[model samples]
Target: MMEKIWQRKTDETIGKPILEVFPELLDQKYPELLNDVLSKGITIRENESIAYIQQKEKLEKFYLDYQYTPLFEKNGTVNGIMITVYDVTNKVEARKKVEVAEQRTRLAIEIAEIATWDLDFLTDNIIYSENLPQIFGQEKGSVITRQKIKRQIHKDDLPVLKKAFGLALQTGIYKYECRIIKPDAEVCWIRVHGKLFFDENKNITKMLGTVLDITDEKNSHQTLMKSEEKFRLLADSMPQHIWTSDPLGNLNYFNKSVYKYTGLFIDDLKEQGWIQIVHPDDQKENINSWMEAVKTGNDFLFEHRFRRYDGEYRWQLSLAIAQKDEYGNIQMWVGTSTDIQDQKNFTDKLEREVSERTAQLELKNRDLINMNIELQSFAYISSHDLQEPLRKIQTFASRLSDLDEQNISAKAKTYLGRIEVSAKRMQTLIQDLLTYSRTNSAERVFVKANLDEIAEEVHSDFYERIEEKKLLSIFTL
Candidate 1:
């Protein structure tokens, strides 16, 4: 380190020969070290004075690497070094921070289309985001309160929503939907999805979220529902008849057209009362058969008579169907009937007219009728015609046996018994054929016959045969 030497404008440099004995004089100038002038120059920084200012940080001394003459007092000149030494580290660091903050603001605006805000809840004062005022519809830059926001919500949806800030204060998070009143008085739905700001103890300070207008989506849903309702209403008012029934073939729906054809309305009919118009004789059988099919989920292909509006009964062919669900429940049924009276009349008339077309046709067909008659006729003919020959043969064989009793062997008797057995077997086959051909021919008319009783009669016949054969036919069912 070296001491600084100050020089006045008019002072001269110290001589080296006197400065050698007292080396401190090397820092002096003029007479008596010219201390007064130099002291004044050092304190006041005069343009006519010179100062050796060491370039060092804090208390350290330094050498000047570069210097130039500096202008001092007015009308005066000073020859000295103007040192240029500066520590610029703090300045550069401060400039860097300013640049980074500017970049962050630019990026945030570009990415999110958002700005910042501050609010004072108790004072009801609001400091908006930079973009907020430009984007607001009717309430730009207005001081907002909890009440003001609540009033903007749609009247219909108002009952469900709470003040966002109040809810945020009580709860840790805030989420909801609301509508806003636009500048043009148009109602707009905005979805606000966000988080609530909190302090260390989880006390909410403010709420923040993103807002989106969703008016288009809500409008679409309402339009679709209205279209669906129109379709359903049109179907209900249609004139074409649509009906469904239970498995028992009950009348579940009688459309307006059906009511117009039949004089009776749906409520006027008792369960299956439509059967009453069936040509009385066909009613029982037609109803019973159709119902039997319904119980088993089978097709109901039946023809019946329906009473028309003109007080006449017309034959109708009804086609019915059933629908079953995954659990096999009869989910639904469908039925429709078509007029078939003309076809039925034509068929009946033709059958009567062609009953006796040929005598040969009658003979072959009549032989297929009446099993009991066929059996009696066979017995009557065989007893008179075949019995004589059979008896004569048996008598002759017996007479021959007696004559050969002393001359014939036992083999001869066995051969005679075999001949009798063969004759009996042929008689049984002829009786069986006649019975099978005539079964059910006598009762050919189709009716609602008592099937259970008919089955019982067949059972009785089997029992009688079993008793005669001494066989017990045990039944488990």
Candidate 2:
């Protein structure tokens, strides 16, 4: 009410003509008051306001509901005018704030990609926001209907939306996700959430809902699932017994080879159950080493026997490596057991055969050495024994020849000469035998010997026979 009163400081000349009193109010803002009333001498009424500056150097704005009433004399003609103003600034400011908040709400909805809709179930009509058509790939603010919205939904998802809405009357709320084909034929996923508004009679009156574009979130989840499936398929297809466990070494998965080799099912292999297939002698060592590797995030290697499906233990080379994320945190442990039984058996057999053959060859070598020594001894004795008999024959032949040649006949002389020659030949054979023995038993030293010296020695030894037989002369060249 205090703001409704026009101040005297601003209206000091209020009793004067309108234009002369408030020169700031041009004909544009107070048009009828200045022209129609003052010139035509008639009543004018309107709802308009003006701003005026007062004594406080502060701007004061006003909204007034004013009327101009004409005053006349006893005659029928008008003579004067009366004007009134009432302030309505508070109403104007309150309405302006409401408009500003509405504009903000609209902008926020667009930024969040939320499409709002109101469905009047009684009329079977749906009213959508201005941007709803654009969300469905149509021009903005285009006319749309319930049937048209249903047609935009993917055929496969139509029944799902129908079912959800059918129950909404009883539930008072409905929420669902489905795919829709836009007007341009591009597919997208959307999430709808709404609640039913009920009348006082507890009957459904309308429904309000918001739609959100969830295409990116849906695609990302699908891609992750596909990657996991592919990894499982590859692991199961391997020939070696492949397995994986959590970072703490708690086993979680095993490939098909593991089940086939161990005669165990997946349910039986949870946690530490895989240890049952390890040979009793190796179980403790295997478990301890595996735990150590997991604790340190290091590669693990061990060789141990494992029981197979047919109840036989075979040597297996077990290897494990830590699989880590980009941050270097261990995500899991991957391990494999490769069959090495055949190679192990072959190497052991080869070693045993090599050892046996070495022993046999050593014994044969000793026997050959002893036999060589005995043969050398016999050669030396034979050469010495033969020389003595030949020398005795030569001695007897020489003595008989020395007997008087006049008493001996010619035939006796020829027989005695033949005996002497045979004795000389025997002595030469013995000398050669001794030389052969020396070469075998003694270490021979090579020395340069003169050929002329050796020939002279042979000639001196046979000089008597050469002279008697009148043989060719021996030259010592």
Candidate 3:
């Protein structure tokens, strides 16, 4: 090819190598390719050289190997230079795309915290994802084999896992939720979801799966279940009357206290039979409300009186509610009923005591009223009797005081005046005493009043006494 190109007519083709024809090629289009040109340019097309310049000036480039190559020639240069064109863009771009995809896959594996595995069931060969090292607690390229994978699973769960995995392979369905053991002897739960594909022969050709660490979620669920069971047992063992009912108001369960209180066996109060023991006054309303809750799928909470073992009625505060399904349908109702019998007993005792105290108070009040009436009559009679004597003494004394010297001596007149003055003072004192004592044991009546207004009235009544005593009194709230 090189000899043919060199022997061509000068007018038909320029034998100058591509670099000789375009001496500034390295400095022209892609200067970064200078190293590439010096190291690798000649190896691409060493048989060819710049053969012709198409432009009138030396700036034009023409193809010598084919029309794709561009060649140029300088005006004064004796020896021509050759420049070679090599196409490497397509391969480089393809390699870059592959590198990007690999990097993205690696980044995804790191973020998910998940490890993947591939198995060729036909060859019994196993390949692991890049993240396998973190999950296995081993470095990359650790010894991985079929036996190693099987040994990592929990011993007790091996059979169960194998059955599920086999079923998936046979059915082309994904098997999931297998627990495994880590090398650290830690019990780790893993949710393995894998799909198996089969060839035309119905033999599994490939199996791919993802491995996740589910130890925390599983442990949390078990802990919650255990806590719930503990609470249920504790509540069921209590002595307080306990009972649970369905959303339709049907009694489903009851503790020993309920049986003891009602004298009814477990079988006696099934369905709606318990309503027969409710107080007649509240039974209809209670049953209606419970039925409404069931119809509406709302929570039921009510309290009513029920018949006791002694043939007497007892008040019970029963609470129940509907436990609903995801679609808001009432599935069941569960609640506890506490005896409240002690509360009823205490309340009855208090009511009886209050009634007895009220009766005693009425009797005492009647007695106090009667005594006050009698005392008021007695005071009126006594004050009238005393007033008549004082009036007579004052009249006689005043008469004697107005007498002449012959009838009454000056000393006698002075004594009479003194006696008349003293009699009037005594009468005034008796009247005031009667008024004060009259209010002491009168009829007792109670009414609510504004305390501040009452205090103001009392203060006015004592104003004179306070002024007479010259006392300064300070009152505050």
Candidate 4:
């Protein structure tokens, strides 16, 4: 073994001096150690001692376990040194690599603010990482034990941790999130994860675990909870029945108005659905519309009847819109149901009244048409039948006027002349009446009129009456 380590033949080293066989030892502690063993007649041993040896004409490093003992002469004087050596390079190098890896792991844990611990049941002691003390707000290098860790836990959380430990004994797994109080009395959240080890007798022998500070995460969660609570309170105060659903169309939240209107609790709605409150006839359409809106992520609008708590079904106009995220993905559905029973009743009443009024107007319009036709016939008859007799009177008076003056008396002539003038005026009045009636039946065309002619005609028609009343002077102009 020595020859192989020295890269030389056994015969070359067996009787040779130690320095001659291994010239590199002259610069190392091996020579001095050998000298001391010989002079003092003592022995020296070393394990895993580093040495540089010449191999293949090049210096190489090695780890060795070696011993040096003095060989004594019968007179009790040290004569020589006996040496023993064994190579331990592989074992030592493996240990060094393991130590380096362990150091790196410790550094990573510290940077991530994690504490690792190991508990030995037999020793009733805990071995923890360097950062464990700091996690509990203690000075560096402070000794940590299971009892010390337990004391740091919040009083309310101690029982929880105990329960977790008890379960771990049976399950071989430990997991819990709990609150802890630091030495400064600051409360914080932590998550612990561990695994249990058991001996052959099924007794827990050791436990290894890691702890993480989760205070920031817990604080953020709490803030979100408070905000949601505020939203719920505001929703409850509204008069409209409001509700919300998950992205999958699962109804999850309902406002106070919904419960008051439907007279159903949340648990009751959960077992079935809000559709229970829909009027029986509207249920099918309501379900279809809602499902379509959810599938397409579109707004929903439907007018349906909702059964009230008092057993009366009232009309409701329901509208729902999808709440979307930045990516345009549906996050939730917000919906409202507004009571429109009164408005619906008003609309129906107004339609009925309008229909009745329309029927009455049609009847009145027919009567007006019949009355206009009768008036037109009366005007035609008055123009033809009445004017014919007046024409005969004027012709007869003309014939009489043509007779010799001696044949008719002056009184008879005057009367004949008055009769003829009256007949002519009556005929003119009848003709004017016919013209006015004809114009009324169509679009009337207005024209400039001679006021003098109209006045003369009026004077002729009333002249006799005016003369008899002795008021003829009124028409002198």
Best candidate, TM-score-wise?
4
**Candidate 1 residue-wise lDDT at 60:** 24
Candidate 4 segments exceeding 4 Å error: 1-173, 180-188, 198-205, 265-267, 309-311, 405-425, 438-442, 465-477
How well is each residue in 183-272 modelled by candidate 2, as lDDT tens digits?
677898989999999999988888898888888889998998898788779888888888888999998888898899888887777645
Prediction-by-prediction clash tally:
1, 0, 19, 0
Model 2 CA lDDT for position 220: 93
Model 1 ranges with Cα > 4 A deviation? 1-242, 246-250, 270-273, 276-280, 326-328, 359-477
Candidate 2, pairs of clashing residues? none
Please identify model 2 stretches exceeding 4 Å from their true place.
Answer: 1-150, 162-175, 191-214, 217-237, 361-477
lDDT of model number 2:
0.80
Q: Tens digits of per-residue lDDT for model 1 on 10-122?
A: 22334334344334435534223234333333322222232233133222222222223243556454433244333333455577688899888768754665544444433
What is the TM-score (0 to 1) of candidate 2? Answer: 0.49
Which stretches in model 3 have alpha-carbon errors above 4 Å?
1-111, 174-179, 240-337, 382-477
How many backbone clashes are present in model 2?
0
Worst 10 residues of 4 by lDDT: 437-446
Per-model root-mean-square deviation over C-alphas: 27.7, 14.2, 16.7, 11.6
Tens-digit lDDT string for candidate 3 (401-431)? 7778798787787667667767887798789
lDDT computed for candidate 4: 0.88
